[model samples]
Target: MSTEKKTKINGINFRTDIVCYNKIGKPILLIECKSQNIKINIKTFDQLINYQSSLNANYMVITNGNKTICFNIKNNKINLIKKIPLYREV
Candidate 1:
């Protein structure tokens, strides 16, 4: 697991707030954190979706410290989940 992980997509560099990898060293999750004052919204989801292509993540999360939103990505589709899953579930 790492925070502020740097990644590159299409020649552009991005810093994701948190990234967790699997035993083989492939990123399995990507999380973006925001201050409590900021609410998670469509734009926030879009940003994570954009990052997903390069990260090849199975899940994406956006949080504002108070609230959290998790998404499962499959076939390039995003589906919202009620909560973040336990590490064992991932």
Candidate 2:
């Protein structure tokens, strides 16, 4: 797991909170964390969404300490995932 995952969008870079890699070193999971004061809303998902498309990660997660949402990225779409997969499972 790497805490500083960098991805670029329109020439600007964004840093993710956590990123997990697959056996081949390709990104598999991307997680964005926010302080309790930050609300988990559409805006909170922006970074995760950008990383998923750029890194082509299989999963994306966004949390604001109080609430968390998991997503499975498939065919360029984000779908809700019921649970977070273990490292070995990914």
Give the candidate number with the greatest lDDT: 1
Indicate the residue-level lDDT of 86 in model 2: 84
lDDT of 2 by residue, 1-90 (tens): 799757687798888789889878999998888999998877778767777778788988888878888888777778998877788876
Clashes of 2: 0
TM-score of each prediction: 0.89, 0.88
lDDT of 1: 0.86
Local accuracy by lDDT, each model: 0.86, 0.82
Which lDDT tens digits does candidate 1 get at residues 1-90? 999878887899988889998888888889999889988888987788788888888988899989888988778778888887777787
Q: Per the 3 Å backbone cut-off, how many clashing residue pairs does candidate 1 have? A: 0
How close to the true structure is residue 80 of candidate 2, measured as C-alpha lDDT? 95
- Candidate 1: stretches off by over 4 Å: none
